[model samples]
Target: MLTQEQISAYNEDGYVKIEGLFTPDEVEELGSEMIKIIGDWGEETIGWRGPWREKYLAEDEQQATKAVLMHNPHFYSATWGHVMFNEKLVGCVQDLIGSSVQWHHTVLHAKPPERGTPFPMHQDYPFYPHDGLDFVDCLLHLDDTPLESGSLCVVPGSHKDGGLEHIMGPDTAPHLPTDVYHPDKVESIPIPAKAGDVIFFSYCTIHWSNVNRTDKWRRSVRFGYHDSAMRPVGRYEDKVESIPIPAKAGDVIFFSYCTIHWSNVNRTDKWRRSVRFGYHDSAMRPVGRYEDDPYRIDPNNVLEGNTNTIVSGYKTNSEAN
Candidate 1:
């Protein structure tokens, strides 16, 4: 069960980190699995080559990178999801968004030392379009997420104001694109987590990560979930949908779709292994995009010539009412 303080913190601050959420063995298992997957795919050195490898890699390289344990076939198995969706995680979501949550999808984000780039600041709603306000997400640390490794930074309670409008204007320092949103009121909060800690927040929360500058890697696993009322609008892939998928040996973090979030770049020499899952409200319905609208539209569908749709699935949970 979630404590009153936790609930209050989340509501007021837009995000919260729960400590000792996973056992040491579980974290080690997930970390080892990630390392193995990277080795199997011949990506052990991919992180050392620098940040652009993900984009510069050949189609085969990209495919190989995706084939690791984070994207391994095992995750699709019932056994995988069963372990990933544990009682504590499910209970937390129920406390936040009711008992009728649904699983969406998953992705693993690996950051190698000096190979990761700064993830630009952006609201998640702009990436994913749906109705209602039940989108939520979680981040589970597989390693110590220290400040030097580029911990996640967030604009507290930004979710409460709905998604912020951003413009791709001039580049910020370090040649990164600047995301200008509601200024004067923006405050960046660094969220540091130890292994086994889980961070949860609303989909509308504005968040981003810095570049890793340490010798060690900061790895984490993330998952997102929504109430039954939300559904995909426009093309699903183009629309951002969050899901909670099962994994055999990692902590799960679940959140909503409106949550704005991004990961930091890895500057360390070690590998950062993180997995992500997205879920949606079972009741969510798809809506198209409008050019003049102030709210976020499904970028994949709203942008011309892009047509990827969201995939749907139903995972039954006995705890769900």
Candidate 2:
């Protein structure tokens, strides 16, 4: 569970980091499972996007294309399932989300050293906006990350502005206007973290990162979570903020979904690998397929032993009010 001080930091700055929440063994095991699944990705698993394989395929490349973030590892891998439903991980989220959580979605983001592409500044709300700012994303660090390794950068308190206007950039991703979000006004800050550390932030937070200039790979996993009553308010025109909540290997950080943040490209020669997962409040939200599906316990339940916190929550749709 998060301390009052840590929760205050999140409420005040839009993000907070909790140190050493996971054990070193658990972290190492997750890394191993990720490697096994990554080794098996091919035409059958990668879907279309054949050019991604032809144009950028390296002997040691992480994915077929940078655009393809691997989804639902837990569905195929038991190892991921354990990490996904880890009690400590879910309990912390329960405290912030204010109800029992539901499994949302997970994505794996890996950046190979030296050639990892740069992710531009953007907001996730444009694609997956929900009622108020109940959505949150956590970055689970799988390797040591430093500013030189293209760590995350974020704009503090930017989520309070609500959803800011954005436009599609050359890459077809929705992004803020560079002129208006200038460094002078937005104050981009780099957040460095270690393996097992996690950084949670809001969906509306405006943020971005720089290219990694180190010789090692900077990798981490991300999990998106939401309250039980939250639902999608919009779709990706495409989609994706902030704070430097740093931690050592085995720690997890939680933040509001609207916090503005981003990261740089890995310039190092090491591989940066990370897996992503998510939890949601299922009573009023969908369980992957449909919106009205009844919430199920056990198997994927994160609130297994922590039932006192469960409660019947808010809207199942935007028009409910």
Best by lDDT: 2
* Reference-based TM-score, model 1: 0.59
How many collisions per candidate? 41, 54
Q: Per-residue lDDT of 151-255 in model 2, one digit per residue for the tens?
A: 888887887777878765443456676556644456877778888877777777776755455666566777778887776666644434234554566665554
lDDT of each: 0.61, 0.63
C-alpha RMSD values across all candidates: 17.5, 18.8
Highest TM-score model number: 2
Per-candidate TM-score against the hidden true structure: 0.59, 0.63
Which parts of model 2 are misplaced by more than 4 Å? 42-68, 169-171, 182-185, 235-321
Give per-residue CA lDDT, model 1, range 1-321, as digits (tens): 789899889888888888987799977776677665556652432221232333334454532322111543233333334444678877887788889987554445455554343344455665554676677777778788787676777888788987555433332211112434322235677888898888888878887665565666666656777887788664645756455354455666565776666654343344557777655554544555665774767544433322223354453453232
RMSD of 2: 18.8
Q: Candidate 1 at 204: error in angstroms? A: 0.9
